[model samples]
Target: MALSEITTRLTAAAQAHGRDASGITLIAVSKVQPAERVEAVLTEGHRVFGENRVQEAQGRWPAFQEQFGGIDLHLIGPLQSNKVRQAVEMFSAIHTVDRPKLAKKLADLAQERGTCPDLFIQVNTGEEPQKAGCLPSEADGFISDALAMDLPIKGLMCIPPIEEEPTLHFALLAKIARRNGLEGLSMGMSSDFEKAIAQGATHIRVGSAIFGERVPG
Candidate 1:
């Protein structure tokens, strides 16, 4: 589908859910997609995008930013402590902040830089061991710890197990966010975004639906 069609679908979903379409951020997931495809979406005036890796984004977005300003680049993948500085420099938001160690590192960097991108605590609602999120039980304590360091905790993010119902996870994420007074919910992806929108997703990541199948990076 083209960018417009995907956007139309996103808007329709939001409206169907009784949400104002403009309030929902449609994040174009550009990870592993070809540069031409990403540029094509940008050419269509899309400014918000998500990248799965810091290095890949560093290599891909700089030129795009130079050509098209006001791009909001989000780091939507696992983050390594060693790469935080570079990631902090390039991405506008980090959605996979799931541990105290990483949160402390980000807090330190934010203190030194006097500014940092908004953060979303990734929650492993499915409790999948291989996944990159804090467990559901750990979310409140984690949020407390991160906020104690003055980290800008925007909201909660989650990736439901591929085999399970996504709305259950979305509801879990929204519940965690609500109790913590978080307003942003960066949940949902290409397949289950409409469900996410219904559950109050503030940001939805869509990639292959906008750009065709990604070229492996």
Candidate 2:
């Protein structure tokens, strides 16, 4: 589908949930998508995008930025400690900060570089052992730690277990955000973004639905 169509649907979905569509940010997840596909969306004037890998983003975004100024790029996947400096420099937002070590590194880097992207602590709401987020129970402490370091934490983020009801996870994330006095809730994807909107998601990351299915490497 085209960017316009996806955006129109997103706006309608948000409105159906009594949300102001203008308040929601649409992140076109461009991980693993070729540059041409990203360019297609850029051509449609879609500026916010999400990327999974720092290396991949480093390879693609500089060129895209040269052509399209004012683009917002969010890093939405697992982040390695060693890559914290580069990640801080590249992304406009970092959405997978789930541990104290990573949070501290980001804080230090931001202090050194004098630039910090908005931060979101990813919560493993499902308590999935293999996932990359911090346990839901540990989120409060983690957020506290990040804040103590003066990290620019915006809110919480989560990826619900694929087989479970996503709304439940979305609600949990919303509750977490509210309890912590946060305003940004980076939950939802192509499959359940509308439900997420109803649950108060401020940022919805949609990839396949907008750029088509990923081409397997």
Candidate 3:
């Protein structure tokens, strides 16, 4: 599907949920997609994009930025402590800051570089042990730790369990954001972004719906 079509879908989804489409930001998840494809989306007037890995984004972003100014990059995958510097360097916002250690590392790197990117605390709403985010119960503590750092704490993010209804997770995220006084909720994808919009998602990261399947690296 074309970029506009996906955006249209996202807009429609937002409206269906009685949301103001203008209030929600759609981040085209461009992980593993080439620079050419990213440029295509930029040409289509998409300023926000999400990537899962720091290295892959680092490899692709400079070229895209050269052609399109003001591109906002969101790191939508797990971040290692070592990659905190790279994540701080590349992403405009780091969406998967799940633990206190990674958050502190990012804060330290940002302090050294004098640029702290916006941060979203990742919440494993499903409480999955295999996932990267902090469980919902542990989220407040992590958020407390992150708030003490320099990174601008924007909000929360989560990937709901694939087998269950997403609304449950979305509601949980909303509750957490409300309790924490955070406004940004980065959730949803091609499959459930509409549901997310219905439940107050501020940012939706969509990949396959816009860019299609990953092109082999």
Among these predictions, the greatest TM-score belongs to 1
| TM-score for all models, in order of appearance | 0.98, 0.97, 0.94
lDDT of 1 at 16: 93
Candidates 1 and 3, the one with greater TM-score: 1
Q: Model 3, range 29-117, lDDT digits (tens) per residue?
A: 98888767777888888899898888888888897788788999889988888787778878888889888778778777877888788
User: Taking the tens digit of each residue's C-alpha lDDT, what string does model 1 give over 91-129?
Assistant: 889999999999999999999999999999999999998
lDDT of each: 0.93, 0.91, 0.87
Over 32-62, each residue of candidate 2 has an lDDT whose tens digit, in order, gives 9978898999998899999999999999999
Residue pairs clashing, model 1 = none
Candidate 1 is scored at a TM of 0.98
Q: Which prediction has more favorable lDDT, 1 or 2?
A: 1
Ranking by lDDT: 1, 2, 3
Model 1 Cα RMSD, 1 decimal:
0.8
